[model samples]
Target: MRRTAAALGATIMLSACAWSNAGLPASADETTEDARDSDVILNMFQWSWTSVAEECGSTIGPAGFGYVQVSPPQEEIQGTEWWTSYQPVSYQIEGKMGTREEFAEMVQKCDEAGVGVIADAVINHTTGADTGAGTGTAGSSYALDDFPGIYGPEHFNDCREDISDYTDRDNVQNCRLSSLQDLATGSEEVQDTLAAYMNDLLDMGVEGFRIDAAKHMPAEDLAAIKSKLSDPDVYWVQEVIGAAGEPIQPSEYTGTGDVHEFDYGRQLKSAFGGSIAGLDSIAEGKLDSEDAGVFVDNHDTERNGETLNYKDGDTYTLANDFMLAYDYGRPSVYTGYTFEDFDAGAPGSTATEVGDASCGAEEWTCTQRLPEIQGMVAFHNAVAGTEVTDWWDDGDNNIAFGRGEKGFAALNNTEGEVTNTYRSSLPAGTYCNMAAGTDCTETVTVAEDGSFEAVVPAKGAVAIDVEHME
Candidate 1:
């Protein structure tokens, strides 16, 4: 299975579902096992460019996540608003977060610690709402019909400004989204510029890209630009929001890289909220397989309330734990600081320096860094390449299951604790419990009968491993 940095969402359930051309490789090869190792791909999302390196050190960095999904790295338009990063001034790596050199240093340091970096590439459009003569550090000019010749008007969709016509493929695919200036990606100049920008990052050591607003761009044009990138190791993940079924959908981008599986997040949250049944049901497993990327919340949907966010409270933890426990899409964990309004950015009111500038040590939820959270990473790594087997559930929200023979976990979100005995697949021994707070405050023991008794707390989850067992 190829590791990806893709979009996942809730609103996507409203659209028709689509499937990926490729599936998990039939047999687990060395590459498959390595990729499946949660210790390698356990990821966290960071706002500023250097936040990953500054906050998460080699300790959690190497043992858990291999990389980070950083906020957009390109030059963004200046505004008091936080959405400015969505508005690209140019393709230059320089931005409010950091300069090109600083970004290079950050990526190198993270790489030294055995963690990779995935940049959020926002190439769907340009800075101005229309377009105007503005120069990026790389000397790229912006021209639009609203302005003139800075970036030619022909570069735009030149159709209706408002794109309410979802039926019109051109308006949906080519036209500007959210009043952002649409770039004619098919143009040779534009393709070369994008390639140049990406190549710069490749030279600086970025391993992959999360193509922003991918659903809005012409797949062929995006493909051509991707083809020009220098690194074949550079993975591509397009943000094709909503369901798949349009003439231009996620499938178009799959041959190049994985597209976001938006429906998974919605279903996950619904399941955790008790609106849907637990994971063991064949119905629920089938529901999660529609796409490759699985996540509880992302930058956009977190603001929209259509998806689960940190502010949603403990509910997010339950859903996230379930996602890790169950086999599904490549999980993208959201790691951010506290926020008040829907439109908040990082931990700061203004976009200034990178690293610890935006959010302080107090606010950041370095998700994978937490012991309970890191336990999930360890569980995933221990059970790498194992299919979930020996599924057991009472059908009343309390459940227990094992992944192959490597690990077993249980969850009880009910009002009272659960003291049930079930087959633990794992060897007889004691293992540390993750959901029981830091330093493995709780423990689980498996007997020679392979039956373990777990007293699951109300509204909590527990995980145990064979290796950790005595």
Candidate 2:
């Protein structure tokens, strides 16, 4: 789903699967409902179950993140490579992430903190590597196409070679991706097997899923699998990488749930990398803001340098601040361990047993814990359903906007400080600058006419919501 190239080929198969009542409703109702509770999600990339549990109880829950997207928990190939999680070996809820007991405990603790856990479900395929046969992390052994109790050669796609023609929908869906084994999703037996695994997670109290490589499976086939799930109301966000003129469009998968808006991230990178003024044109883009799950960057893009990340310093924080301020898609912030090699797994052991995550540790990059980003999460939740009103810009690097009367934000992306008097939507009063933190040295006083003058620091931002009013 990350890399791309191909040509058209003969179509291989199609399904007559009917729509499922178990899937989420095809309306903005879910979006509106979710915003009312917690609008922001945190993708805690590659964190161990123990680490996730501790953070959920101590930080993530109190910070008001609606959900945490954890790494794939299924048993997978034993290796230190990060992509090993994508190459699942069995449905057992045990892998480098943690054991089944630890995973259940994490889910329970997160739920207690009012945070839902979104498991990264890797059901599209099994181990595709020709690394011979071996036992997985959970002690499940397998040969090339022979996963003992879970699957056999019959459950895999007939097209047993690497995908050569992305332009061909058949080749893209049925053929192996990057030499990984492709599953026969159209098979009812496979659907039942996948549903059993997902339902097991649901039984463990998981609220939703981030379906990995969803575009590799036919829409109808996915629908068939979803129809068998026990939980009818769980949330979903599909990883469908659709670009202009691509054979697979994100919209095709919307029937199941919201699609990860890769285009939105690209646009944010372009705007933040150049001038803040370019953001004014973002509203006119092709993506429907309501049904999109937006983010500044994800685990994949951050490593590939296609999007801005924590390493970009204040510029990265500013971009996320802008995202939270704007009433676009449902925003998500990412946190992960630091790495030099793109494919390197989490720091510590040989990637067999993940180490405990600690903010003070040299390997962790907890971007979500940054004061500015944390403040913006509250700003996003506080201004839900409010319209983007009173937009103002300097025709260059500075821009300020208000979310009706609920909140206001001014960003100075320029190299030098910017002092500007802008119309505000907030009530007249003294307010602490949330972006600066609770012990902030800066304060803004709005007059009865809803106007305030602010001196925003270069590469820094100031955000104030009704909740932060003094």
Candidate 3:
């Protein structure tokens, strides 16, 4: 790590303390319990275990992220496409990402770096029936209804046809999704098998699991499966994409763990595309803050147009910055490969291997390393536990707000520069423009009244906090 443990701790604790001067910054010594933890999870989508481990020490740990969400590590159907990561054939800890030994090493290294590793658990289904007989990444031969000693036709749900009705909860839970054979999640044997697979990962230092296709299984079944875990208290974030008229909702599974708030990203898309000033009222459509896991974008939403992607350019960065700065659900920042087509794989991916992440602009989006994104990691921590105050906006694309007296930010999504006098809750000082880095040449001066005039660039932002100053 570039910074010592002391330095990282101090940087993260900057704004997570109690304030007295209305919005005055906390002292460096205020290392409260809240300061030690930040709900920042970097979704290293499609990144190899080696790449994720390397990044944990160098970037993720130093950036103040508490966890790294990786692709499914279990053995999957051999393929070059990105979605293949979701197709599980065995729980052997061998996928295109890495081998079992490499996976264990990544967990240890990331743990030493103070970053927890969360696996994407695909317990809802196995390989698609149409995929036919094929060998998995670990050389395990898999047929649609037969996975050697692991599973057979008896373990699958009786609903053999594709899911045709989402409103009917039985079909959605029992039928196959996209011809992928659904598991009999309710059976005692099936739940035991799933629990054993997850226990193996937990034994290897995996801190949590992202329940892939959670909506396809009943909430009771998921709760029962989790109860069988070695540590049922371990984090579990389920992927329940809540639709308005759909019978299943993300709220139904909160008893087991957190649910990804799809509405948060969808609302971000709507607000950022129109008037970002409306963000102050964004809670109207979202799940309860604590139960929700929020992200600017994810693997599915990026391809499906449900949220913004790297292709959206500067607007995408601004949205991510907003996600970190705002007090909402546990925030996860996503970084993934660059592709012209939806089905394309990461740079050098083959049937049994994927290349290391290069983090270049033209190839991998590497959102975690962007100045506007990484710098905000500190800003988010600095302003933790503070409420949004001193809100100001043009009722359009330009908006500015403060997190009590700890920090402040102004976002402008217009084409040209939007210069304005913004209100803040900070004390008088020359603070660093965190849209740049802490060692940045650009700076902002706050008067005694906590107001400053600055030019927020086109589709850009200007952010400052007590902890990040010139």
Candidate 4:
């Protein structure tokens, strides 16, 4: 999702009353009620509204996943490319995912199923193409920087150009990202428009938002816009990619909301790739657990080959298992369609509409359906807020840990199975290995003295939580 810059010589144009209410709720506690208690969020990338609704009723809700981050729901540029969803044609709740009616229905059903919907918002830019005329998926017509009644050329940045330098803060914030038209967020009209769009979603029962390309906008401008939002409690997780020497850092955006921990995925990739012993260092990262939304990989990282995706087979699953079991950040699990071409859209469908998702068919990898992963989700929920204790490592590829008497996990990354006896925090009892679900024959018996013997299979994990105790 990195964007290259071109030039920036224009000053941000703003109206006299651009700043609205300045004292906005900036704490995580101010987020939606569902998000406040959630431990994990599932990123169902590119899944249609109906598909997400079905999964919520069938799998995610029942499995205890807190929320599901759906694809951009707004009307977007008509194209078969996946990135087309990132190019907003209008704020209308109509796009390849489904119609506004269908989206509303999906939200209602998901809410009934005890699952919250977090919309992926593409407010940083509109259509990047210079084509003068086109129709969006929702039948909205547009020409150049004009989005009919929603936005005009004046609402966009005067630069009218792509970002030129990543090292410069002004260029990164003001310039267009990969030719995408940059919005003048400092303008009261732009802030009011974006706030209206977001508030509409909130009014329709949306729980939160994942602000796409948040780093491309100035932090104070983002804060001002957020302040104008009607739902002050809506959860916000910004996509702020920070690296060494980059002037725009994630810390700058933390005041707005939690930022994605990109380094978490990078470190997980390195740990799961060969150095499992290094997993212990994850808690020592610069970002605090309370301020990060962590995941092993995202749609962009998977496409860029920066992090391990479902294509890595068991190794990828193991990484997810570790993320769910470890207590650090609010974990997110990602599942999407697999494709040979990075630019290819989801399976089945055309430029105007996306068909229903057929999980496990035509390169669609529904990793969330895996029993092991589902059990891990339960493990995370069962041990929520519990401190990680009883950390033990074989000083190699084998590791074991307990979560304040609520859960225990042992993972072996080596090529061979490893068995070891360790002290458990759980009360003396027989527990089913959640990794195998209720049908699992393997069970761990903890002694009264809080000791148990575990045999972790090669490249596999054994997880047992209090809820699954037999």
Instruction: Point to the candidate with the largest lDDT.
Output: 3
Question: What TM-score does candidate 2 get on C-alpha atoms?
Answer: 0.92
User: Using alpha carbons, what is the TM-score of model 1?
Assistant: 0.84
Off by over 4 Å in 3: 1-36
Each prediction's whole-model lDDT (CA): 0.63, 0.80, 0.83, 0.81
Tens digit of lDDT per residue, candidate 2, span 356-436? 778998689987778887777777778877878888888888998898998899999888888889898778998778777
lDDT of 4 by residue, 1-470 (tens): 11111100011121112312112123322333324245578999999999999998998888888788999988888988999999988877778999888899998888888788889999888888565578888777777777766678898888877788999988988888988889999998888778877777776778778999999999998899888776554578999998899998988888867899899998888888877876777968557777888899999999998899988888898889999888887788999998889999988769988888977585788888888888888888788768789898877788888999899988888878888887878999888887755455779898999888888877888888888877
Scored against the true structure, residue 207 in model 3 reaches a CA lDDT of 76
Superior by TM-score: candidate 2 or candidate 3? 2
Candidate 1's residue-wise lDDT over 137-163, tens digit each? 233344444322224566556653756
Report the CA-based lDDT of candidate 3 relative to the real structure: 0.83
List candidate 1 stretches off by more than 4 Å.
1-46, 128-151, 244-247, 281-291, 351-362
Task: Evaluate residue 182 in candidate 3 and report its C-alpha lDDT on the 0 to 100 scale.
Answer: 96
Q: 174, model 1: CA deviation in Å? A: 1.0
Q: What are the runs in model 2 whose C-alpha is more than 4 Å off?
A: 1-36, 438-441
Question: Tens-digit lDDT track for model 3 on 1-470?
Answer: 12222332233223222111111112211233433355678999899999999999998888787788999987788889998988887777777898778889998898778788889999999999998998888777889798776778999999999999989999999999999989999998888878877877777788788899999999999999988877777777899999889999888998978899999999999888888988988777677777888888999999999999888989999998888888778788998988878998888999988989887546988888887787888898889878889888888898888989999998898899988998787899999888875466689998999888898899988989999886
Worst 10 residues of 2 by lDDT: 3-12
After superposition on all C-alphas, the RMSD of every candidate to the true structure, in Å, is 8.1, 6.7, 8.9, 6.2
Candidate 4, superposed: residue stretches over 4 Å from native: 1-37, 360-362, 438-440
TM-score of each: 0.84, 0.92, 0.91, 0.92
- Order of models, best TM-score first: 2, 4, 3, 1
